[model samples]
Target chain A: MKYTEEHEWLRVEGDLVVVGITEHAAEQLGDVVFVELPELETQVAKGDEVCVIESVKAASDILAPCDGEIVAVNDALSDAPGMVNDDPQGDAWFFKMKLDDMSVLDDFMSEDEYKAFIG
Target chain B: MAEGGQNGDLQRTVLHDLHLDLGAKMVPFAGYAMPVQYKPGVMAEHLHTRAQAGLFDVSHMGQVILRGEAAAAALERLVPVDLQGLAEGRQRYAMFTDERGGILDDLMVANRGDHLFLVVNAACKEADIAHMRAHMDGVTVTPVTDRALIALQGPLAEAALAALVPGVAAMRFMDVATYDWDGAALWVSRSGYTGEDGFEISVPEPCAGAFARALLARPEVAPIGLGARDSLRLEAGLCLYGNDITRDTTPVEAALGWAIQKVRRRGGAREGGFPGADVILRQLETGPERRRVGLRPEGRAPMRAGTQLFADDTADTPVGTVTSGAYGPSIEAPMSMGYLPAALSATGTQVFGELRGKRHPARVVDLPFRPAGYRK
Candidate 1:
């Protein structure tokens, strides 16, 4: 698993990368009321905004970590956005991305590095 | 993101340490470090307020005393409420109008027998004080800095508060009374913004924390933060000073005409004596071009404030703009308040709110999304 400065976590599963916001980010957002996920199969570049998370306080964007194509999205989030707050790191994974170069994941921060970065 | 960088410039209320102890997420509001939510978060706090009781630290709001024998008559020259007709121990909602018929600030005026007690918005208090002092003569506008204001609101508010002050149980909605608690004189009004049966207690600054802790000691009462307070008021269809009603919005346009009594209207005994009487009264008779209306969006996604409303999906120009929008925890739906042209402001009218470059359908509804639980 790898983390980005934007507080998103990426885990490699076979050839796909599952993306979701970290528990710290979810805790900061309080309660998630809505989540606007990207369309399946949409191509996105690094740093491009891919999803929008709306909490009771305000709305925030989840940027794409690397150049990839969205392969699958968690439709359950559309029905129960609160799941993001309940299980941000586990079942609340936002989407699965097919990265063009799998080696790009090595450049991201490790779990310890991300924790220190948040501090 | 939470407020920082200007920490030195922000002020703290009397309950600051208490909020910190309760694990409140403090945020900057109107130049004060106010708690936006406690450990329960906004959703739970909102629901808790509706289900039981929620104590709010509203000390940041400006409390003032208008003294002298001619205070009521002098105040009549500013707001459009029937101040003279207001009986002692009663309060009325009023707004100071500008020369252009726009609202300068909205406040609560309570007749305290010896003087009038006014509670104005925190952001507009300084300007409101200056405006009152500049216009009204023979009346002393004394800013009360030694008092802290706290509101206990909910369906069980009376039960929780009556436990502390037995006299509060006898007070009806909008009734004001003075009571002694722990050697402190508490000026309490049976009024709140949550549309619930509640009381706003003005306590001496030194004892404010103890008073709040006493209320919180009750099983029905919990400390709610500014975030839940906002959502509760929004669900109740009440206006935030800077949001729903502004200096550019009039009483009629903001659907606040109900607050203006007949005695202050056209052809009444004390008509046209207040500021912007010409335009406000004219709008009162003929109606304004735009009107504030409640909205229910079609989806779970909230069409937040500043979202432009159009007549349809393809309109080039917006017909209105959302002022307050949130997911109402009690109502279990996304509700909003915004302004629209009179022709398109009817209930059930279809409108489109542009969000994320897509036009989402929303229906125009009546002012309050939920029924008020006032004890009146």
Candidate 2:
């Protein structure tokens, strides 16, 4: 698993990578009320806003961490957005993407580095 | 993002440490480090208030005492409310209007027998106090800095409070009374911003922490924060001081004509003595060009404040802008309140709100998406 400064976490599973916000980001957002995900097969560049998460207080953009083509978007989040707050890294994974460049993943922070960065 | 104090030095409320102790997410609000939400988060807190009771630390709000032989008369000159006939132990919602008929601030004025107790927004308190001091004569405005305010709101508020203070259950909506709690005198009022049956209690600063703890100990009571407070008030269709109403907005334009009782209207006995009376009374006689109305967007994406509104999806000219908006938990949809031309302000009028640079269909609906649960 790797973390981005924007607080999203990515985990490699076979040829696809699952994306979701970190626990710290979920806690900061308070409660997730709505989630707008990107369409399947849409190509996204690193740092592009691929999704939006709306909480009771405000709306925040979820940016892409690595250039990839969207493979599967989380359909479950459409009915239960609070899953992001309840299990941010697991079932709450926003989407799965087919990585176009594995080299881009090296730029992300390790778990320890991410913890230090937030602190 | 929260706005810190002007000079970078954030002020702390009396319940600052208590909030931290409860793992509250503290953020700067109105120059104070206030809790935006606790561990349960804003959504839960909002639902809790609607179902049960929630305690809010509103100590940042300004409390003042206006005292003089002609205090009521002096107050009438600044606000449009008819205070001369306001009986003791009653409260009224009022605003300070400028010479041009714009709202400077909206406040609550409670007649406490010998003096009038005024509660103003934290951000506008300094200017409100100075404005009152400069304009009024024969009255002394004293800021009550040693007191902290706590709001106990929801269906269970009366029962929760009655357990702590015996006579609180009998107080009707808008009733104000003084009660003794733990040897401290508490000024309790059956009024709140959530459109619920609630009480706002003003306790001495030193006792605020203990008082809040005692209330939280009740089975129905939970500690809420500013985030829930804003959402609750928005769901209730209440105006937030700087957001919904501002120096550029007027009561008439904000759909607050009911607050300007008939006693202060053009044909009233006390016709037009307050500041901006000419313009305000004129608007009262003939409606304002634009009025505030509730907006219900058609999708799940929340249309937030600052979102522009157009008459139609293809219209080039924007008709209005959203002032306060959020996904209302009680209403179970994305709701907002914004200003629109009087013709387009009618309920069921089709409109479009520009979100993420695209116009989305919406409708102008009657305010207060959720029914008020006040114990009237």
Candidate 3:
């Protein structure tokens, strides 16, 4: 697993990379009230804003970590956005992206580096 | 959510230490390091306030006393409220108006028999004080700095508060009185920002911590923060300063005409003595071109402040704009209030709020998404 500077986590599985926010990001957002996920099979760039996360306090955007096509999205978040706060890195995984090269994940921070970055 | 850092210059309220102890996320608001939420977060705090009692630290808000025999009459020249006719031990919502009829600040003016006690918004306190002193000749405008204001709000507020101050239960909504708390005198008002049965207590600075701790000792009471307070007031359809109402928004346009008593109207006994009487009175008779109304967003996503409203999805120009918007915990929906053309401000009117570049459907509902539970 790797972490992006925007507090997003990426994990490689088969040909897809699962993307979700880190626990620190979820905690910073307070309570998750609404989540707007990206459409499936949509092409996205590294800096493209693909999703939106709304907490009780304010709204925030989720940026794409790398060039990829969104293949799957967690539809369950629409009905229960609080899951993002409960299990951000697990069940709250926002989307699965089909990346051209999974090796791009190596450029992201490691788990220990991410912890120090947040600290 | 970025936890706010303690800015060295920001002011700290009397309950600052207590909030930190309760695991509050402190944020800088109106020059004060106030808590935005506690350990339970905004959603839980909001729900808690609706079901039980939530204690709020509002010590940063300005409290002032207007003395002299002509205080009420003098205050009448600034606000549209009928302060002169307000019975002793009662409070009324009021606003200071500018020459252009725009609201300077909204306030609560209570008749304390010997003097009028006014509670003004924290951000506008300094300016409001200056405006009062400049306009109200012969009346002494004295700021109360040695007191801390706290609000115990919710359905169970009365029971929880009565446990500490037994006299509060007998007081009706909007009523004000002073009671003995230990060795200190507490100025209590059966009023609050949340649309719940509650009390706002002004305790001596020294006793504020003890008073707050005592209230939280009750099982029904929880420590709420600014985030919940905003959501609660938004659900109540209450106007927030600098948001729903501002220096550019008039009372008539803001749908605050109800706060202007009939006695101060054009045909009443004391007519048009206040500032901006010419324009405000005319607008009162013939309705303003634009008016404030409640907006109910279609989906789960909140139509927050600054979201533009259009008559249709394809409209290039915005027909209205949202002022205060949030996810209302009590109503379990996204709620907002904004200004729209009088023709488009009716209930059931369909409007589009532009969020994230996409126009989503919203309805122009009546003010206050939730019915007030005040103990009248």
Clashing pairs in 3: A28-B1, A29-B1
Tens digits of per-residue lDDT for model 1, B315-347 = 899999999999988888899999999999999
Regions of candidate 1 where Cα sits further than 4 Å from its true position: B1-5
- Tens digits of per-residue lDDT, candidate 3, B54-74, equal 999999999999999999999
- The second chain of candidate 3 has a TM-score of 0.99
In candidate 3 the C-alpha lDDT for residue B24 amounts to: 89
User: Relative to the unseen true structure, what is the C-alpha lDDT of residue B73 in candidate 3, on a scale of 0 to 100?
Assistant: 95
Off by over 4 Å in 2: B1-8
Predicted candidate 2 versus true structure: per-residue lDDT over A34-65, tens digit per residue: 89899999999988998989988788999988
Model 1 residue B37 CA deviation in Å? 1.0
TM-score of chain B of 1: 0.98
Clashing pairs in 1: none
DockQ of prediction 2: 0.67
Model 2, docking class: medium
Report how far residue B96 has shifted in candidate 1, in Å. Answer: 0.6
